[model samples]
Target: MVRGRDVILEALENLNEDEFKRFKHRLGTQPLRKGFSSIPRGTLHSLDRLDLTDKIVCYYLEDYGMELTAEVLRAIGMLEEAVRLQQAAGQV
Candidate 1:
């Protein structure tokens, strides 16, 4: 499953500064999906989520047969909402 931890893990596996920066740019933007935004709100610290999401995407595409589709991004957005739900319920 594509999770935030997975994102952090894969990116660090290679540890290339320039490539990481490039990924950050590509996945950083408004509306979230275009920039590989997984979290629902595009606010401060949400970029952190994007950075993680980017890594997960990279890994998923490699091990599994998948592309960075807008729909897929949107679906992941739902997962972010679930986190908020858990937090709201004081579960996080």
Candidate 2:
């Protein structure tokens, strides 16, 4: 079985620099409430793709991490990537 972390990493790797930046921006700026918590700007600022993937998995675990990744992807207009992630994560 494909691990959720690997799925997320692949999705992030598919992004170009600009799309990755938008993904990071959306993740960092999300309002904290209930089940959603935003990563600090400083924390996200220096992360490369692998580091960001690790952080998401560490912060939210596999299932929620994948979901959050998809959410951020969708927010950045990476709808195809989001759907791919959702399918990979078994959310579709």
Q: Say which candidate scores most in lDDT.
A: 2
Per-candidate alpha-carbon RMSD to the true structure: 12.9, 1.9
lDDT string, candidate 2, 1-92, tens digits: 68999999999999999999888989987654377567778999789999999999888888888988888899899999999999889832
> What C-alpha lDDT, on a 0 to 100 scale, does residue 40 get in candidate 1?
31
Each prediction's whole-model lDDT (CA): 0.37, 0.87
Best by TM-score: 2
Off by over 4 Å in 2: 32-36
> Candidate 2 overall Cα lDDT vs. reference?
0.87
Backbone Cα, N, C clashes tallied per candidate: 1, 0
lDDT of 1 by residue, 27-67 (tens): 34423323343433333233444455554445334222122
Cα error, residue 45 of model 2, in Å, equals 1.6
Measure candidate 1: CA RMSD: 12.9
